[model samples]
Target: MNESLHGGVGKAQIKLRTQDFPIKEFVCQHDPLYIRALFLQAKTEFLLLSLDLTSLTESMVYDLKASVYEEFNIPIENIWITVTHTFSAPHLDKSYPIFIKKVKEAVQLSVSRALERVTKLAISTDSVTTSLNCSRNIETPFGWWLGRNDLEYSNHDIRILKIYEIKTDHLLCVLFNGDLPPSVMADSYLEQGGKAVSSDLIGYTCRKLEETVTQTAIFILGAAGDQRPLEKSCEDIVSEECLKRNDLHEAGFKLVETQGDRLYEEICSSLVKPNPIFLPIKAISIYEKKVFLEEKVMPIPTKELKPTKHFDFSKTGRQQELTIAGVSLGSIVLLGIQPEVNSLFGEKLRELVNVQTVFIASMVNGAIKYLPEEKDFERVTYTAMNTQLGRGSSKQFLEEVRRFLKESNLSVDKQIN
Candidate 1:
């Protein structure tokens, strides 16, 4: 690999209509959220791009990659596309020809604008107190797990990233968590409407964060596979409908005032403008080798298993890596386990990376479902109990982290191992 390839980071945020419904479940459905793109560049070249979309088909990724490569001549591997996973958006999978054309145009506009306005900036960090959310399933006696989707079990914990201009007092990125599962309104409603497509909580959170911070904020949806709104009950979807709109608007404003002031104070005292002392830039990559599930010792069921809420396992010795990329400004890493990752996993990653003064930001690349530890996995719930991937996956991931560090030649403290 070209180790000498210097990384020059640049970011651009382009706002589009908030609603998108590329696919409709029934004959008719409406999309509700607009999309946004947070483009990142390294050394005047593309490194990663986060497409905060309402919804779209998997093929869109390939299509986007092909288009960007043809036009900009950037390698496909250098680009990473992620959805905010907002439920209240369009689904390109089922949209009409006109709609698809519109989507492609919107995406291109965002990309072009972002790439055009790239600049160098410094990033600061802060954290909010953990909210009350958690996992809801556990293992069963038969070596399986079961559980339900409960909002109370969501990961309320979130970190705030303050992207600042090196010389000026301007803000660049306001990154926060959008772990609320994508159910703003049901698919039935999403496939039909297109009044004002936009980014939901992810957008609302950023808009709110920007009011006070004087910089742009980009919200990323974290590990929220099994988490849902407690208030979004089965019988009454109306309440959820009402709440979704209200929350988006209110949080947009409140977050600006409250979080902005708090972050401003913290950043002012902790940081200085115009080439503040450079922070350490540590980038580590870990790859764990293991047999694919197809090659597992146990036979996977021929048919996809029925959905179960709980998660549990009985396998041994799997390989997965908890990789970390620590920059002077912050930490970005891939989580080894499932989407519904808990504080425990966050704590473990921090321990492995072993950074004294830094913020923890996870799911930087892709997402697995929810991953509680072995003991909690046994308790079984919607995430842990019913995971299609076996319990051994967690152990494999942990081992991979160990192997990854060793392979990278980054000295590992005995305590972390």
Candidate 2:
């Protein structure tokens, strides 16, 4: 079941003119926000609800899960809720109780509708290349800055998981897992009297795909902690110059349209191809690890004094339990981890797994700051500085995932023999 949770006309919104505090007035909606639920009942029954929101808190996930289980009698563990990480969407806050109510109602409606018309599913996977994203960590004369890092390693692969209705062979939902947010075009609206809220690239892509397929389109953010959409094309001298000269208005729209069209073409082509391997859906495995933070020695400043230099570096025995969730669907696997994971970790996992397709959905379950690779600790990058997990925490987490995948593969081989 799919329903809109759009906060409508006048409401407090997030990621729009953030400079303005206590935003009371509402902005014009460019597109509707949605909550799409896809219920599966093959070897195992489960519900995957995708939200077009900025982010979700752990408490919200727990509440949504409890509500669904209590009403539908489905296991709480069977529910998987993910967000598109749309910067222009609303964030949960005390000021918006009505918005929360609408979300709960939408989830129930979507689940009920999905349960009513349960259909056999056929899955196909494809990829598309887009010049939209780049690493945001750049090295400057003073220090490393959070900007466009063209030389840094970033995932440009846009993995598409197309779920189809077996009987009619119609597209049910298309899950777009990419390392860029749809806020490129919407951010351009900021200078033009920041009274416009839009889904930007993502919403536009979905609308275009729906025009032909008439199906639900879901966007899941990948490891984009250090990644951002290209603000300017190669033809442009600089992003700020384009924005200052009002060139971004036209260029940004064209880029969004071209990229959306390219993705749509890929989806159409993949749908026509035959021989999609359907794997029996397996149970999801949740692994939890308690991570402890340790104090690091700060280097004395030789240049101007920074605020961080004055802060006390003390380990107050701060600890967090990180959860890693893995679900296997034949050769394709979906791994969801809490917090914003770095692209490097995702790349390493893919190389180790060697699967046909492994969709690494970041910011799942809960947000725990950033999860950067062990090597990232060497440099004072934004992700490393903002992370709660220790230096080797990411490596340890990846090892656990690799072990689980290996054990599962061995068990399947033995059963086959």
Candidate 3:
């Protein structure tokens, strides 16, 4: 007989209210930051930890894994750590080492609280189609640039996972998959010594969910390498050169806040569903497939690059190779990729995986950079131009994920447990 599934959820604030370091002393405070953890217990255990900050570091990651392993015998591979990928927060620079130290302590406490409260928890899956996000890749007279392009490919579908107590039937926590970076204020004028540490969309919206809903909400980045908030912080981004350099994108705090409010309202539609369909998670397991792609993507001349409207995805969509990893909670499979992926690729991979239900998250494990679609290589979109990965990289990534899912028997590697 399989071991019964049990889960616990815990969250602790980073107490950013009085923090002085904000990368360049440009940001001060908007709301308190937090680190949340969800512990899944079974024959094999997994700790899913999410941070509100911008990203993670090697020392911070390894140290937390070591600490968790010391406290609980779960292996390092089973401890999954992902960030909200908020762009307006502090950057990983000279002051990161100190800030990360505090993050480590709070994260450890949250994990401990979760582990201590292991109880029977059931999961229900639902999704909401939203227009809060749009494709950021646009065709410039100069070439592909970073601008709002609603006509192009954009992922409006957001996957939601609700964890509820099996005994009381009360919702315990919510895990929502964010398709884009929480970067609405990414290029804002906050750089002009604005004393405010904003969480942008992901942080702002999720924090609201926790406060109003009164349940822990953990955010996981989905295929959002090319997606951006429909309401961008600044306006009139003219040149591709300026966009790439992060030079001219200006600030509009009101725009980002409005976007957050819109996203929060839309997500609530899915959250407050009259009834939810829970997955049969009798057993839990994790799987991963690694591909060694060393060939660097050579750059195409900007003048020769094509625009977004020129390429037809139906005819041009192709597959190639990439590193794919995932975990199975019974029938529902949660897959992850390390690089930032475009919205179309995310949808394509989900369709090909052949699973009854699957959620593909990007920037998982760690963030390598952007992985634009195959045709983007020919067109040299902003992503295609900036990514160090070579042509057909995204296609290859899809092909590998397809293979991984098939071999894993619906994309889940069955092992000890």
Q: Of the candidates shown, which would achieve the greatest TM-score relative to the real structure? A: 3
Pairs with steric clashes in candidate 3: 28-195, 28-196, 188-251, 189-251, 297-390, 319-395, 320-395, 320-396, 321-396, 321-397
Instruction: Tell me the tens digit of each residue's lDDT in model 1 across 1-417.
Output: 112122222333332332422334322222223334444433434334455454333367667767767876766655555566655444554435555666566556556655666555554455554332344333333332223334334545455555555545466655555344433332222223322244443445444555555445555555555454322212121231231222332223333244334434433343244443333333333332232321112223423332333323555455333233322212344323223355445555445654443233334334434454555455443344434456655555555555554554433354434
Task: Give lDDT: candidate 3, residue 1.
Answer: 16
Q: Each candidate's root-mean-square deviation in Å?
A: 7.9, 7.4, 5.9
Cα error of candidate 3 at position 217, Å: 0.8
TM-score of each: 0.62, 0.78, 0.85
- State residue 329's C-alpha deviation in candidate 3, in Å: 0.8
- TM accuracy, model 2: 0.78
Ranking by TM-score: 3, 2, 1
The worst-scoring run of ten residues by lDDT in candidate 1 lies at 232-241
| Candidate 2: residue pairs that collide | none
Choose the strongest candidate by lDDT: 3
lDDT of 2 by residue, 79-162 (tens): 778877766656777586666776777778777767776666666678876667788776544444455678888888889887
